[model samples]
Target: MSSPEQRAAAILASQRFVVIGTTDADGPWTAAAQYRLRPRGLYVESDLGSRHARAIAVSGTASGVVYDSSAAVADADGVQLAFSAREVDATEPAVRAILASRLPRDAGPVAELDDEVAAVLAVPTKRLYVLEVERAYVFDRDAWRSRGTDARIEIEAADVWAALGRP
Candidate 1:
């Protein structure tokens, strides 16, 4: 059994990836986009006025998937993780600057946002679901842990919200 600190480290160390889920008017929407893991959260880039930017504005909720396929390539054990997150717009100059420093230049300039484009995507995690693989056997973390999923050490939505201090 892993300790709480180990579990936390596991989550923190996992490389982030992207998945596309869809929304109609103002909820979860779909699109396959590339993203990377950062210490703060998941970071993705898109232009303003794009479907993703608009959907995030309308719904404020989104989901992403990250897989540890390294194991597949390395012939080692691995896990796939899914994240439910809320998107925060990096529209403010300061936020844009912070994102700019972390993201590539082609993503869009921090200062030169076209009237129609959004700058950056700030995805704060709310929930995480992980699937573990052992010797080609796949199982949910709960099953691997011999307990309910809730029994695993994870940050609750309230804890994430408090840490972000966002409304």
Candidate 2:
């Protein structure tokens, strides 16, 4: 049996991005953005001009979801964990390097040309939130509930780095 930590790590390890949910005076907004899981928290790069970036700057609240699709349970019942956090600008060289490392290769040369991507680089924020896992449920049609828990998981940055086998 997979320990909760291992299972959680697997969920994160398998995914490179998360749907960042933000709120404004109007209502809530959700968008899927690429993220780099680091020894500290989750890192995301966005254009300073994008709606999401503006939202993060004005309000630090955000949410993310990670799940296990390989479970024996039904497809709809895959184990999923949703979380929330506070945003921190990943402006420093060290943090940028960490975030860069987590980026999917398919991200292309978007960050390669320093001049063209300057707007995004300026706001490369690492989201540092309380990471409240709102829920964890199996999506399987029949055996879903038997496979998961609605437990609050405390995942530190070190743990993420450990799972990645990074120092």
lDDT string, candidate 2, 38-103, tens digits: 543456655556666666667755666655445564433223444544444444554344434442
Best by TM-score: 2
List TM-score per model, in order.
Answer: 0.43, 0.56
- Per-residue lDDT of 140 in model 1: 48
The per-model lDDT (C-alpha) reads 0.40, 0.51
Per-residue CA lDDT of model 1 for 119-140, tens digit only, reads 2323332211111111111224
Task: Flag regions of model 2 displaced more than 4 Å.
Answer: 68-143, 146-161
* Candidate 1 clashing pairs, residues 3+ apart or interchain: 21-29, 21-30, 22-28, 22-29, 22-30, 23-28, 23-29, 48-117, 48-118
